[model samples]
Target: MGIVVNQSIKNTFITFVGFAIGAMNTLFMYTHFLGEDYYGLTAFLLSSANIMMPLMAFGIQNTLVRFYAEHQTEEEKSRFLNLMLVLPLLLVVPIFIGLALFYNETAELLSQENPIIFDYVWMIPVIGLFMGYFEIFYAWVKVHLKSVFGNFVKEVLLRIFISIFLLAVHLNWLTSIQFVYSLVFIYFAMMLVMAFVAFKVRKPEFHLQFPKDKKEVLLYSAFIIFSSGIAVLLLDIDKFMIGQYIPIKEAAYYSVAIFIALTISVPMRAMHQITHPITTDLMARKKHEELNQLYKKTAITLQVVGGFIMLGILTNIHQVYALLPEKYSGGISVVFLISFSKFFDLMLGNNNSIIFNSKYYRTVLLLGLCLVVVTVGLNMVFIPSFGIEGAAIATLISIGLYSIAKLMFVVFKMKLFPFTRKTIISLLLIALTFVVFYFWNFPFHPIMNILLKSVLLAVWYWFLNYRLAISEDINAVVKKGLKFNTPR
Candidate 1:
C-alpha cells in the first residue's frame, strides 16, 4: 500500500499535468490553429493507429508484465525479455507486407466518406508501429516497478511535443499535412526514449534461447493480442467509425467531448501504472487475500477521486462548452454520457489488471470480442441517425455492458468484489454534491465559474469523505497532507 500510494500520487499528479496540457491543445490550440476538418483527420489517424497497435506489437507489452515475474533466474529472465523483444516482429513483418500489398484498397476503404483520409492512411500503420513498441518498452519498465519516469515520458513528454508541433503549425512553419506527418516522428522518437529508459532500468542480456514455458508464453501472447486489440478497439473504434460513417470533422467534435470525459479516468490510469505490476506479482504468488484487499482499496480510492472529477466535469459541463466554439458545443451530451461511462470504469479500480492476469483471461477475451461486435453494430445503427452523440450512446452502452460483465466475472470466479457499504456512501456523496452545486453557478466568466464551483465541491466532498472514513488510504493521505490528527 505504501509503494502503491506513493507512486499513484506521483503518477496522478503527472497525469493531471499531462491532461492540463492536453486540454489546452484539444480545447484551444487545435480548434483555433488546425481547424475542425484537420483536427478530425488527426483524431481519426491516431484512433486508427491505436486500433492497430496491439496487433503490430503482438501483445508483447501485456505479456511481459504477466510473465516476467514467473522466471526465477537471471538467465531465464533475459531469455524471456529477449523473446518479448523478438515476438512482435513475427506479426509486424507480415502486417507491413499486407499493408504494402493492399495499400490502395485499404486507403480507399478508409477514405470512402472523406478523401482527405486517403493520403493520411499510410500514417496509421507507421504510428501504430511506433505505439506498439512504445508500450512494449513502457511495460518493460513497469515490470521492474519503475513506472514513474516511463509514465512521465508517456503522459507528459508526448503531449508537450504535440503542443510544440501544433504551435509550429500555428506559426505557418508547418502545413497541416506536415503537422500530421510529424505524428509518426513524434511517436517514433518517444518510443526510442522509452526503450532507452527501459534498458537503463535493467539492461537485458542478448540471448536467442526461448524460455522453457514457450508454449504457454506464446499462447498467452496470442490471446493477449486479440484481447488487447479488443480493449483498444472499444476505446478508439468510435472515433474511427465516426470518420467512416459521417463527416470527418465530427470526429473532431467527438474527440473534444471524449477528451473532457477522459479526465475522469486519469487517476485510474495513473494507479494502473503501478498496480498492474503489483497485481501480476500477487497473482503469480497466488496471494488471494491480499489481492482481494487490493481490489477493494484501489476501487474505493479511484471511485472517490474519479467521482470528484466527474462531478466537476458534469456540474460545469455547460461552462466548459461555453469556452469552446459554437460548432463544438453539440457534444455536451456526449461529455455527460462518456463521463458517466468512464467514471463507472474508474470505480472498478484495478479490475482490468486482475482479470487480464488471471487464467480466465481467455474467457474475458472472448467476451470482449463479442462486445466489440456489439459496439460496431450499435455504431452502425446509431451514428447515421444521432451523429457524434450517437457514437457516445454506442460507447456508453458497450462500456456499461462490458464493465458489468467484467465485474460479475471477477465476483463469481475469484470470489472477490470491489464494492462495499462505503461504495454506496461514496455514490451518495457524489450525487449529493452534484445536486447541490450543479445548478448553482457563479455569475462570472466561464473559467472563474469553473474554479469557484470546483473549489466548493472539493471542500464539501473531501471533508465528508475524510470525516466518514470512506477510504482509509485516502483519509491517511488527507491527514498527512493537513498534518492533523482526526478521530476515526
Candidate 2:
C-alpha cells in the first residue's frame, strides 16, 4: 500500500505537468499553428494508430508482466523475457507484411475522406510496433519496482517530444502531412530512449533464451494478444471510425472531447502503473486480505478525487470551452458524456488491474472482446446519424456497461466490493452539491465564478467526511502538511 501510494504520488505530479503541456499543445498551439481540418487530422491519425497498435504487438507486454513475476530463477526469467521480446516481432512482422501487400487499398480506405491519411497511414503500424515493444521492455523494469522512469518517459517525455515537433511544424520546417509522419518517428525515438534507460537500470544480460516448453509461451502470449487487442480497440476504435465514416475535422473535434474526458482517468493511470506489479506479487503470495484492503481504499480514493475533478470540469466546462475556438464548442456535450463514463470507471477503483492480473483473466478479457465488438457496432450505427457526438455516446454506453460488468464479476467471483457506508454518503453529498451549484447561478466574473464554485464544491464533498470522523487518510494528509504531530 505504501509503495503504491508513493509511486502514485510521484506519477500524479508527473502526469499533471504533462497534462498542462498537452493542453497547451492540443487546445492552443495546435489551433494557432494549424487549421481546423489539419488539426483534426493531427488528432485523428494518432487515434487511428492507437486503435490498431494493440493488434500489432499482440498483448505480449502484459503477458510479460504476468509471467515474468512467476519465474523464480534468473535463467527462467531471462528466458521468458527474451521470448516475449522476440515473439512480438514475429507476430508483427507478418502483420506488417500482410498490410503492405494491400497497402494501396488500405491507405486509400484509411484516408478515404482525407487525402492526407493515404500518405500517413503507413506510419501507424510503425508507431504501434515501437509502442508495443516499449511496453514489454517497460514491464520488465516495472516488475523490478522501477516504474518512475517508464512513467516519466510515457507521460512526460512523449509530450515533450510532441511539443517540439509541433513547434517545428509551426515554424514551417514541416508541412502538415509530414508533421503527422514525424509523430510516428518521435514516438519510436521516445521508446528507444525508454528502452535504453530501462536497460541501464535493469542491466539484464542480452541473450535470447526460450523456455523448454515453447507451447506454454505461445499459448499465453497468443491469448493475451487477442485480449489486449480487443481492449485497446475498444478504447480507441472511434477515432478510426470517425475518420472512416465522417470527416477528419470531426474526428479531430471528437478527439478534443476525449482528451477532456480522459483527464479524470489520470489518477487511475498513475495508480495502474504501480498497482499491477503489486497485484501480481500479492496474488502470487495468496495475500487476499491485504489485496482486498488495497482494492477498497484505492477505489474510494480514486472515486473521491476523480469525482472532484469530474465535477470541476463539469461546473466550469462552459467557461473552459469559451476559451477555445468556435469549432470545438460543439464537443462540450461530448466532454460531459465522456466524463461521466470515466467517472463511473473511477468509481470502480483499480478493478481493472486486479482483473487483468488475476488467474481467471481470460474470461474477463473474453467479456471485453464482446464489448469491443458491441462498441464498434454502436459507433457504426450511431456515428453516421450523430457524428462524433454519437461516438461519444457509444463510448459512454460501452464504458458504463464494461465498468458494471467488471464490478459485478469481482463482487460475485471474489466476494469483494470496494464499497462502504461512507461511499454511499459521499455519493449523496456529490449529488446534492451538484444541484446546489447548478441552481446558485452566481453573478461574478468567470474566474471568480470558478473560485467560488470550487470552494463550495470542495466544502460540500469533504464536510460530511470531516463531521462523521471518516477519512483517516484525509486527516493524515492535513496533519502531515501542518506538521501537527511533531514530537513535543
Candidate 3:
C-alpha cells in the first residue's frame, strides 16, 4: 500500500501535467491553429501509427516487462534487452515490405477521400517499431522504480513539442504536411530521450547472455504479442473504420472528441504503468493475497480518481463542446460513450497485467481475440451509417465487451474479482456527483466555468470516498502516505 500510494502520487502529478499539455494542444491549439482538414490529416496519420503499433511491435515491449525478472544477472538482463531491442525490425520490416508490395492497389482503393493518407502509410512501421522498443527500454527503468523520468518523456515532453509545432503552424511557420511529419518526429524524440534515461539509470551491458529458459521467453512473447494486438485493435480500429467509411473530416472530428473524452483514462493509464510489474512480481511469488488486495485497491482508487474526471467530462460535456467548433460538437456523445468505456476499463483494475503474467496467458489471449474480432466487426457494421457517432457506438459496445470478457476470465479462471463495496458505492456517488454538478450550469468564461466546476467535482469525489469509507486498503494506503509524509 505504501509503495502503490507513493507511486500513485507521482503518477497523478505526471498524468495531470501531461493532460494539461494535451488539453492545451487539443482544445486551444489544434482548433484555433490548424484548420479542420489539416487537423483531420494530423489525427489520421497518428491513429494509423498507433493502430500499427501492436502488430509491428510483435509483442516485444510487453514481452520484456513480463520476462525481465527471469534474468538475475546484469549480463543476462543486458543481453535480453539487446535481443528485445533488435526483434522488432524482423516483424516491422516485413510488414513494410508487404504493404509496399500492395501499395498501388491499396492506395488506389483507399485514397479516394484522403489521398494524402496513402503517402504516409509507410511511416507506420517506423513509428510502431520505435514505440515497441521504447516500451521495452522503459520497462527496464520501470522495474527499477525510476518511472518519473520516463513519464515526463512519454507524457509531458512530447506534448510540449506538439504544442510548439502546432503553434508554428498557427503562425504560418510550417505547412500542414510538415506539421504532420513533425508529430511523428516528436514521438521519435520522446522515445530516444526515454531510452537514454533508461541507460543512465541502470546501464545494461551490451552482451548476449540468453536465459536458459528460452522456451518460456518464446511462449510469453508469442502470447503477449497476440494480447497486444487485441488491445490495439480494440482501441484504434474505430479510427481506421471512420477513415474508410466517413469523410476524413469526420475522422478528425472523432479524433478531437475522443481525445477530449480520453482525459478520464489518463490517470488509470498512469496508474497501470507503475502497478503492472509489481503485480507480475507478486503473482510470481504466489502472493495471491497481495495480488488480490492490489487488484481491489487499484479498481477502487481508479474508480474514485477516474470517477472524478468522468464527472468533469460528463457534467461539463456541454461546456466542453462549447469550447470546440460546431462541427466537432457531434463528438459530445463520443465523449460520454468513450469516457464510460474507459471507466469500465478502470473498473477492471489490473486484470490485464494479471492475465498476461499468469500461467494461463495463452488461453486468455485467445479468448480476448474473439472479443477483438467482434469489436472490429461491429465497427464495420455501424461506422458507415452514423459516421463519428457510429464509431462512438462501436467503441462503446466493443470496450464493454472487452471489459466483461476480461472480468469473466479473472473470475472463472483465476478466481479473482476487483469489486468491493466501495466500488459499487463509488459508482452511485459518482451518479450523484453528476446530478449535483450537471444541473449547476455555469455560463461564465469557458475556461473559468470549467475550472471552478472541475475543482468542485474533484472535491466532491474525494468527499464521497471519505464519506463511504471506501476500500479499507485505500484508506490505509492514504493514511500511510499522509503519515509518512508528515515531518519526522
Candidate 4:
C-alpha cells in the first residue's frame, strides 16, 4: 500500500499534467490548426495503430509482468528476459512481410471511404510497431517496480512533442500532413527514451537459454496476445470505424469528446502502472488474502477519485463544449455516454491485472473476443444512424457488458469482489453531487464557470467522502494535506 500510494499519487499528478497538455491539443490546437478533415485523419491513423499495437508486440509486455516474479535465480531471470526480447519477432517479422506484400491493397481497403487515409496507411503499422516495443520496455521497468519514469515518458513526453508540432502547423512551419507524419517520429522517440530508462533500471543479461517453463511461458504469451488485442480493439475500434463509416472529420469530433471523457480514467491508469506489477507478484506467490484486500482498496480509491472527475466533466460538460468550436459541440452526448462507461470501468479497480494474470485468463479472452464481435456489430448497426453519438452508444454498451462480465468472472472464480458498502455510498454521493450541480451554472465566462463549478463540486464531493471515511487511503491524504495527525 505504501508503494502503491506513493507512486500512484506521483503518477496521477504526472498523468493529469499530460492530460492538461493533451486537452489543449485536442480541444484547441487540433481543432483550429489542423481543421476537421486532417484532425479526423490523425485520429483515425492513431486509433488504427493502437488497435494493431498488441499484435505487434506479441503480448510480451504483459507476459513479462506476469512471469517476472516466478524466476528466483538471476540466470533464470536472464533467460526469461531474453526470451521476452526475442519472442515478438515471431509476429512482427511476419506482419511486416504481409504488409509489404499487400500494402496497396490494405491502403485501398482503409481509404475507400476517404482517400486521405491511403497516404497515411503505412504510418499505422510503423507507429504501432514503435508503440508495441515502447510498452514492452515500459513493462521491463514496471517488473522492476520502477514505474514513475516510464509513466512520465509514456504520458507526458509524446503529448508535449505533439503540442509543439501542432503549434508548428499553426505557424505554417509544418503542413498538416507533415504534422501527421511527425507522429511516427515522436512515438519512435518515446520508445527509445523508455528503452534507455529501462536499461538504467536494470540492464538485461543476454542469455541463449530459455526459461524452464518455456511451454507455459509461450502458452501464456499466446493467450495474452489475443486478450490484449481484444482489449485494445474495444477501446480504439470506434474511432477506426467512424473513419470507415462516415466522413473522416467525424473521427476528429469523436476523438475530442473521447479525450474529455478519458480524463475519468486517469486515476485508474496511474494506479494501474504500479498496481499491475504488485498484483502480478501477489498472484505468483499465491497470496490470495492480500490480493483481495488490495483489490478492494484499489477499487474504492479509484471509484472515489474517478467519480469526482466524472462529476466535474458531466456538470460542466456544456461549458466545456462552449469553449470548443461550434461544429464540435454535437459531441456533448458523446462525452456523457463515454464518461459513464469509463466510470464503470474505474469501479472495477485492478480487476484487469488480476484477471489477466490469473489461470482463467483464457476464458476471459474468449469472453473478450465475443464482446469484440458484439462491439463491431453494434457499431455497424448504430454508427450510420447516430453518427459520432452512435459510436459512443456502441462503445457504452460494449464496455458496460464487458466490465460486468469481467467483474462476475473474478467474483465467481476467485471469490473476490471489489464492491462494499462504501461502493454504494460512493455511487449515491456522485449522483447527489451531480444533481446539485448540473442544473446550476455561474453567470460568467465558460472558463470561469468551469472553474467556479469545479471548485464547489470538489469541496462538496471530497468533504463528504472524508466525513464518511469512504476510503482510508484518501482520508489519510486529506489529513496529511491539512497537516493533521490521526488520534492514538
Candidate 2 lDDT, tens digit per residue, 365-438?
88898998899899999999999889999999999988899999889998668888778877876677677775
C-alpha lDDT score of every prediction, in listed order: 0.92, 0.79, 0.78, 0.91
Q: Write down the TM-score of every candidate.
A: 0.90, 0.89, 0.87, 0.90
Off by over 4 Å in 1: 1-10, 67-82, 143-145, 199-216, 274-294, 484-488
* Candidate 3 C-alpha error for residue 89, in Å: 2.6
lDDT of 3 at 304: 80
Question: Which pairs clash (backbone N, Cα, C closer than 3 Å) in model 2?
Answer: 58-225
Weakest ten-residue segment in model 4 by summed lDDT: 479-488
**Weakest lDDT window of 10 consecutive positions for candidate 1:** 479-488
Ranking by TM-score: 1, 4, 2, 3
User: Predicted candidate 4: what Cα RMSD to the true structure?
Assistant: 3.1
**Candidate 3: count of backbone clashes, pairs at least 3 residues apart or interchain:** 0
- Which regions in candidate 4 have their CA more than 4 angstroms from the true location? 1-9, 66-83, 199-216, 274-294, 483-488
Q: Taking the tens digit of each residue's C-alpha lDDT, what string does model 3 give over 45-145?
A: 67777777766666776677677887887777777877777666667778878887998776666666677677776665677667766777777787777
Instruction: Report backbone clashes per prediction.
Output: 0, 1, 0, 0
| Sequence-dependent TM-score of model 3 | 0.87
Candidate 1 Cα deviation (angstroms), residue 310: 1.0
**Residue 77 lDDT (model 4):** 88
Top-TM-score candidate index: 1
Q: After superposition, how far is residue 36 of candidate 3 from its true place, in Å?
A: 1.7
